[model samples]
Target: MSDEATGQDPAVEDRFETGPIRPPSEAGSYLLRLTRGCPWNRCRFCRTYKRRKFSLRTVEEIEADIDAMARIRDRLAPAGVAGGPRAAVRRGVVTNDYEWMVANALASGGRTAFLQDADSLVMKPDQVRRVLAHFRERFPEVERITTYARSRTVARLSVDDLRSYGEHGLNRIHIGMETGHDPLLELIKKGATAELHVKAGRKVKEAGLELSEYVIPGLGGREMSEGHALDSARVLNAIDPDFIRLRTLTLGPKIPLWEAFHGPEAVLTRQDDAEIAAEIRRFIEALEGIHSRVVSDHIMNLLGDVEGCLPDGKADLLARCDAFLDLPEGDRRLYQVARRAGLVNGPADLSDPGVRARAEAVLAEVVRTYGPGRIEEACRDMMLRFV
Candidate 1:
């Protein structure tokens, strides 16, 4: 169909793309796809970019996308100023995916942007600098620009290069340091060691960029939970990142980690909610000499409320974990069911009678269907839904 016939702008529509996922905190930010897939897609616990080949978009291509997004902003700005972007969309004024992306970002104040897909820093340093400069020129309102990068990729770049990126427009880098335990890193094929993670994280800090290191609470399974927690804490202590985000592990049959749970030679045992909470407690306790904020922002995290600043909030974070652990067996199970079902945030929610009653009802139904012994399995099934 002709563009005139369909009322579509091919320049804007065909020039840009978005990736599959972004951090939960970036729910409102504009997404700019700099790469097509993960540079290292071999992590067994991750299925995000599997089967897709990684490729970098050129400076010209990314600039084209920035231009398209700016066009979208210009088209939607009047409607947004009159009422709002959402109202415009409801009234059929905002048309096309590109317009929606711009509208969403505008509605959220248009202060942030995230570069995708996996390792954006893998692009040439000069190219990244040019892209960031062009992006700032297009969207000067964006105050924070962030991207996902592998620790190994960050390690490959000199501190000067990262600092230059920061000087351009980039503000933060999020690294998936799933586990700092050597055996678990190898088991999951994370493609980097603990030492490399520390090196990369330190370099990022030295370059004056905010860093968020993600740690999977159950990446080591039951057998190596202690080592996972302790070693991860050791690594974080060395790096002292700006943010320590907890993303609990959730495995399904499609990912290679599933093989560790099934078949004759199975070597790993999945930890239940209680076991994971204990491991998290141990991990939090092991965190020392770092001022990073512990964030439980993801829905997959069972203790979604286990977040606080370090040093001062350290005791409180432990108490929050203990709050869940100290609940009666039945109450703990009820809270687990409620959390997995999205009915409640954490054990603290159960203090309210209404929330407690609702959680009890959910627990009863889960017990009736999955049987009391399999409540953990039911919770695992629920967690898989988020994955």
Candidate 2:
């Protein structure tokens, strides 16, 4: 029936809450917001939720959202926008604004869900368990439920609390762990020490949770680059996380980390792309016998082909970085601009005539308009798009 006949407000729509940030792997999962913002917002390099205040959604409010999601899923099921309907579903009839989320989830088979905001594990253990239980009860098909967490918080939680979380179907945790060098961690005001990262990582792993620890390659800049690479490897070796994600540091004018780097009382000296790639290579070489997957998936990274598992694919990962570094200076510049502009994936793309032409054209334009000195700067600035 039309809004006029049913006396329903046509403009009113179901509200599905989502946080501002999530891991790259969670792109296809259902975004279930449990918190409003980052509780520890003092990380200088991160500006994800600077403008917003931190708060937790009450258990009642979160449950209301879960109920709303269930209703939306049900409404979209018959329409074949969710739950893998075999028949062709007519899409024109579902006019609600939130139906697109269901449609996207249906495309992926809807088996994973990511809890949102910077850290959802900061909630009370009983509260977290109840929310997880409610979520699993409502959607039994969701096989994996993951969330971002802080190392200090994880360290403080009792083993029983973490195990209970696992029992409630909380499958994974992604911790920043940006740098393991104490000075660098202190410089960034991460509010967690290297020891905390090791302890917390071990605790989570012991709880039978898959841990993804993110380490930033250029976080320590030029002065502490060596320590950043070696010490980070040391920490990762100690924890032996399931995933050792490489997030190459990218700074912008708005980021406090950048301001600090450029300030008179600078804490870090920024490194160029080549230097950062070399830093990554050093980190990879220093890694010893840890079974973790290294992912350089983001565009901000100078090399994209460096993903592989440790103790097995480590040599190939090293060769990928070396190959990029071995490229002729002129070709390297062309490839850097191409990668930053989203024009190519890796050096292999340069073999394609069409791809090479596009990259050369972009390189020529950058050199002509901005001058040779500005090419690197332009590429670095382009990274802001991904962030």
Candidate 3:
């Protein structure tokens, strides 16, 4: 662990899950990479950040990154404050979470910081605190900090340590909850169970820091898709985090799932993404009480763009899914084309007849070029994401 204050490397540093979080007030938010990759990278259905190894970055390294961001924040500071720049800086300094911290830091002449690697929290609490303090002391303007944490790490930690970090302005955490089904988790070699996921989520909530949970559709596959939906719902229902981000399963090279599919005689035939849509529909329908905002921001998900207030927009969301299902098979293929092109994902609108026709046209070419068997090939490629 390199102490930023002393310019010495700590024995270890922070790591991050390979993703970013966007806040509504994202103008000031910073993406702190706290974890390197998924510690349990063996999941059959996952590919995001799986190619990387897990590591803890040094405190100095993380602080240095923050210091680099401080310059930008400093320049923007004068604009956001209502009163004079001094007042702006003062208010910005007190915000405990990262966005506020960075924004405030910019206003206050402090730097905003984002943690790196995978599990930053894996560092000793005192070490993390020192890093935060050094940032605080040196920047005096950085008011907030954030990092990613695994359920297992959160569960293993004593709450006081967490509370201390929060007090130090280590403000937000993102948890990857791909699916909550225990059997599915087992299939994927996810390190934590549904219970641990909740325990970690609630602990973050209890600590008074912001939390975002990620869920990936189709990880359970058609065989266990229903269980994936219901069981994942069960897990989220317990935590009810600030956000439940959507990440649909997409394939890449070297993912273990592809190996499984090819190995022991490829038992699972690829679903036409209609199954992916169905899985999303089921997931939305199953969600219950708790004010959680669902987000489908990634291109890999069939409903990658579909998300809204849960259980309330649930009806409309499902209706959208039904509409997609109603399209002619050719039109459905169009939507799939759009999905691959990153033009469309999610249960959102693909109503433009032209877009659908275009999708169909594209699918025709794809089929002509690669054959229908290519879907399986694509799925296999997606599964290789971990390697």
Q: TM-score of each candidate?
A: 0.95, 0.93, 0.73
Each model's lDDT comes to 0.89, 0.84, 0.64
Which pairs of residues collide in model 1? none
lDDT of 3 by residue, 191-224 (tens): 8899989899999888888788888776766778
On a 0 to 1 TM-score scale, where does candidate 2 land against the true structure?
0.93
Question: Which parts of model 2 have CA positions greater than 4 angstroms off?
Answer: 1-13, 82-90
Worst 10 residues of 3 by lDDT: 1-10
* Tens digits of lDDT, candidate 1, 1-387: 112122445463544788988898897788998989998899998888898988989999888888888887777777662354556556776655566667777878889999999999999999999999999998999999999999999999999999999999899999999888999999889999999999999999999999999999988888999999999999999999999999999888898888876678678888888899999999999999999999999999999999999979999999999999999988888889999989888787988999888888988998899998998999999888988
Model 1 poorest 10 in a row by lDDT: 1-10
**Model 3 regions more than 4 Å off:** 1-54, 68-113, 136-145, 265-270, 345-349, 353-361, 371-387
Q: Tell me model 3's lDDT, rounded to 2 decimals.
A: 0.64
Using lDDT, give the best candidate's number: 1
